[model samples]
Target: MIKVVKFGGSSLASAEQFKKVGDIIRKDETRRYVIPSAPGKRTPKDTKVTDMLYHCYGQAILANDDDDCEEYQRSFEDLIEKIKERYQEIIEGLSLELSLDEDFKVIKENFSKKIGRDYAASRGEYLNGKIMAAYLGIEFIDAAEIIFFDEEGNFDDKKTDEAVAKRLENLERAVIPGFYGSGPDGKIRTFSRGGSDITGSIVAKAVHADMYENWTDVSGFLIADPRIIPNPKAIDVITYRELRELSYMGATVLHEDAIFPVRKEGIPINIRNTNSPEDKGTLIVEDTCRKPRFIITGIAGKKDFASITVEKAMMNGQIGFCKKVLEVFEDNGISIEHMPSGIDTMTIFVHQDEFEEKEQKVIAGIHRAVEPDFLELESDLALIAVVGRGMRATRGTSGRLFSALAHANVNVKMIDQGSSELNIIIGVRNHDFQPAIKAIYDIFVNTMI
Candidate 1:
């Protein structure tokens, strides 16, 4: 059995964290492929290495200007020196013979040449992977050598799979840096932030591993935001569709994009904690017959939404009326999140931040297109999604949800549910968001007795 494990920045933030990660990997023989992220914060006030690199590179770019070239050059060099010192400290703490002198030399040269920001940001993961491999006595495999991107900047899945599969098949064990791949021109390109998770998923797919383990600071995903529902239970198992729904509403532990790669290959991801490896954490799978502990799997919500409500007589009989209304939003570059309609009324929910500037133009366009009898715009809305597969089997879930909200005295602004019965989205005033989530959790979880 083979397992591919990826450690987040928090898991390898310091020498102490590195030692913990090493022990976790060594304790399990099946963990043959490892992925390491850049160093993160040692304390709440500490900065991430990737953020530092970005800031330093910003200074390097400014150094090209002749007006203050000397000042910017010194500033950039100071940041570089700090980076080097931090790595040296980690090396000393681990008592590793490896010296990063040549690595630092190459970085200095790259900064002088201004290779690119992607190259600069990726150096964190690259250098960390080197240290991890050396400390573990395993081979170091660079992600750029395997993961490929096309000239258009799209990930080349077919090309990457062949390259990565063939390469890892020949190796017994290896550590590959996360978050970056090589472009068609052989220049480095990076995924979006939290991309190390994506890299781990790609590696797991390439190796066809039995399971992919993601080690991070959190034990797992909670049923609701702990700040809202104190000591919420951890989700034992969640399906890919359910996870996507919750992530959309704001429960973000794993990068949402990370699910696609291993999901297609039918590989389950185990979200584990580096600090407490004994906990089972959360298990994400494509499909499962396993029963959920509660009628609702999880609750997540997002704020700052505005809804446009349009009412017209005989709207149900008027075909294409909704399409015309939606086209106005599309033309204005605003996307709709949810649309709950009655026989004569329809409300379009959109992000307030996106709709605020163009509200007048969009309203005018809708007036010309749909010619509704009455139109109203409301902002400062929050949407909460209660998602679960078990919801389909459980009757009166909606009734119970409304009951909980009424008890909490939070008014419901809107309600929508998919035909699949996988989720129910409730809209409330921004002030009532947290209380609504807590109320729902209590009815389903706390009051279970």
Candidate 2:
């Protein structure tokens, strides 16, 4: 069995943290294929190494008279030097007697002079990878050489697959950096924020590992935010569909698009805590997974939303009413989040920010395109998503959710349940988000526990 372990920025922030990660990795040999993220903040007041690089390079773009690029270079050097010093300290602290050479001095010096923003941003992972490999005495492989991107900056799966396959075919284990792959022009291109999560999935797919372990700060995916619901239930196992629904609403574990590559291979990903390895964490898997006793897995939600309601007689029969309502959104550069409707009324959910600066135009567009006797716009709304795969298999999950909310004296404004039955989204007053989630979680999870 092979495990591809990807450490988040927090796990690899300093030499001390690096030593902890090393001990975790060394505890099990199956954790051979490793992915490292750039060092993150050592303290609340400190800035991330990657963020510093971005600001430094961006300053270079805007450096008029200050010639701050050189100064930016010093901050950059300080960040890297700090990272190196941390690693060297880890090695010394652990007394590993490892060679921290062949990097930073020669290879890094040349690249710093002619590096693009993506390359600069990627150095966090590169520096962390070097330190981790040196501390662990493992082979260090650059991700840019393996993770391939196309001309338009989209990832090239075919080429990346072939490269990673060939690279890891002979070698059973090594430390590979995450994020920032090579572009078609041989320059560097990076995935958007949380790109390291994407890199871990890609590598998991490339090597066909049995499981991918994402070691981060959290123990696992919780049913609800602790701030919202104290002692929230932990989802022992969740299907991809359930996870996706909750993630979109506001689940904070992995990026919403991070599991695409490995999803197809049927490889399960574990969200583990580097600080607390004993925790079972959360197991994300395909629909075929049969573990977990809860009929409703988790609840996640976000605040600050607006809902536009349109009502017209014979609305269900009207051919162009839906199109006109959507056109209103399209014309005003607004995107609808959820659409729940009845025979004569339809509600379009949208982020408050989308409507804040452009609500009048949207309302005017609706009036002009699809005039209705009853049209109303409401704001200061929150959406709570209750997710579970088993909810579909067994009935009454929706009934239980509404009943729970009712008992808690929480008023729900709108509800949208997909045809897939994986999640039920309920719109409530922004003030009710916390109580509503806690109430529902208590009924579904606490009753079982």
Candidate 3:
């Protein structure tokens, strides 16, 4: 069976880390394709190679624009040396006879020419991919050659899949850098941060791998944010639908975009810990027949949302009422997070940051569009999602959730649940976010113990 493995920056931060990764790959011959990120922080205080590249590139841009940029030039040269030293140390530690001198020369020239930030950011993965390929004695495939983006900078999925499948057809083992691809103009373009996960997923789909292993520092995804619930229980297996709900609520073990490609192909993704390779970690799949160990798979949430409540008589009977309300938000360029409505009451939840500046305009728009009996706006709200497939089979899950919050003295401002019974969302004051999560964790996870 073929496996596609992607290692995060922390897993490949130093020579020792690289050695650990080498062993992990060598142990599994079926792991034919490898994806590597740029070197991450070596220590808590250390800087990531990607950040350093950005800094260096920024300095280069300043030097080109300003005639009196001697200081910026010096700083740029220093950063370049520092980046080189980082690679040199890894090469020495691994005792590999590889040279990046020519690559650096080309990079330096490109930087001086004011190459795009995407190009600058992608260097980390490119440099690391070279080292990884050399150390493994495998072919190095540049991601730009296979991954494709359109003129508008949107990822061209069909083109990318076709290119990757054709390119890897003849290769037995190869190392491809993550986070970057060539646009229609042949210029480098990058995804938002944490894009390497998306790259790994794309590769897994193209090759139709049996499993995609994502190695990182953590053992697996936890049922609750560790910060909220100390040493929270780990989720052993999670369905893609459950993961999406949790991710949307702020759970971040895997990139949200990463789920789509592999999900369509029905390939399972294993979240493994590189530091502790023996751990089974979390297995994310499209669907599963195995029952969840807990009544809830995970609890995740975010703070600082604002809610607008519109009250109107005979609202349920009014045609185009909800549509008009939604159109106001759409015209104002504000996305609604959740809208839970009753017979005459409808509440719209949105990120506070997105709605704060345009509040008055939206209020006026709503007044003109819906002509509600009363309208009220409230801020400083947080939404927590209790998601699990087991929730459907278990009775009184919502009752237990309300009980937990009431016992914790956390006021619930709003509650919404999807028809699928896959997730229940509760909105509370920002300050009660932690306590609310703790209470729910105790009810669903700790009580089971």
Candidate 4:
């Protein structure tokens, strides 16, 4: 049983952290393929290596266009020295006989060559991977060599899967740096922030690993945000659909799109805490027959949403009415989050930021499309998702949610549930977001405990 372990920035921030990771990997021989992120913040006040790279590259760009670029050049040089010092500190701390002098020279020259910001940012992972490979005494495989991107910059899954599978099929152990694959031009291209998770998932799919272990700072996801609900219960097991629901509502433990690859192959992902390996953490699977511990698995919510309600007589019987309404949003380049309807009324929920910019255009488009008898727009709304697999089997889950809110004196604005009964979405006022989450947590977790 092979396990592809990916350590986040915090887990590989320093020599001490690297030692911990080394021990974790060495203790289990099956932990073969390793993915490493660049060094993250060593302290609360420190900046991430990736962010520093971006800033440094920003100075480099300014230096190229400006007539008086001495200051910008100096600033870029200082950041480069700082970054090199960080790696040197880690190398010395580990007492490794590795020399990064040549790599640093190449990086400095590449910056002068204007190799693009992707190349600049990717060097963090590249350099860190080298350090980790040397420390672990394993073969280092650059992500650029295996993870391929198309000419359009979109990831080429077929190309990447074939490349990674073929390359690692015979190798017993290796370290693959996360983030930044090779583009069609053979230049570096990076995924969005928290992309190492994507790299790890891709590797897991490539190897058909039994499990993918993601090590981060937190132990696992809690039923509610800790800031809102103190000491919230940890989720032991969650389905991919449930996690996606919560992630959309703002739970945010892993990258939103990272679930796709491993999910396709039916691989379970274990979100483990590097600081506390003894903890069971959270397991996210595609599907499960195990019963949930409570009627709801988790509660997550986001604020600043606006809902557009359109009412027309006999709307349910009217063909293409809903489609016409959706077309207005699609035409305006806005995405609808949820659309819940009644016999004669239909409501569309969207992010307030997206809607506020094109409100008049969207309203005019909707008016031209449906010509509704009544139209209303509600803003500053928050949608909370009460999600669980057990919700389908248990009755009164909605009742309990409403009761909890009512007791907390938080008025509910709208409620919608999917047919699968896996999640119930409740819309409330923005001011009541925290209170409503606390009330729901109290009903689902505190009372049970």
Q: Best-fitting candidate, measured by lDDT?
A: 3
Cα-based lDDT at residue 108, candidate 1: 81
Off by over 4 Å in 2: 59-114, 289-291
Candidate 1: where are CA atoms >4 Å away? none
lDDT of all predictions? 0.93, 0.83, 0.95, 0.93
Q: What would the per-residue lDDT of candidate 2 be over residues 1-449, giving only the tens digit for each residue?
A: 98999999999876677778988999999998888888787899977878876765554444333564576556655655664575566567666756656665643454445567788788778877877887788899988889999999888998998899899999978888888789878888888877888888888888889999999988889888888776776778888888888888888789766788889999999999988988979989987657567877888889999999998899888898899899889888888888999999999999999788998888888889878878898999999888887788887878888899999999989888889888888999999988898888788888887
Q: What would the per-residue lDDT of candidate 4 be over residues 79-130, giving only the tens digit for each residue?
A: 9899999999999999999999999888877887788988999999999999
On residues 137-157, what C-alpha lDDT tens digit does candidate 3 reach at each position? Answer: 999999999999999999999
For candidate 1, the TM-score is 0.98
Per-residue CA lDDT of model 1 for 378-412, tens digit only, reads: 99999999999999999999999999999999999
Q: Which ten contiguous residues of candidate 2 have the minimum total lDDT?
A: 59-68
Q: After superposing candidate 3, which stretches have Cα over 4 Å from the reference? A: none
Report the number of clashing residue pairs per model: 0, 0, 0, 0
TM-score (C-alpha) between model 4 and the true structure? 0.98
Candidate 3: worst-modelled 10 consecutive residues by lDDT: 60-69
Candidate 4 residues lying further than 4 Å off, grouped into runs, are none
Clashes in candidate 4: how many?
Answer: 0
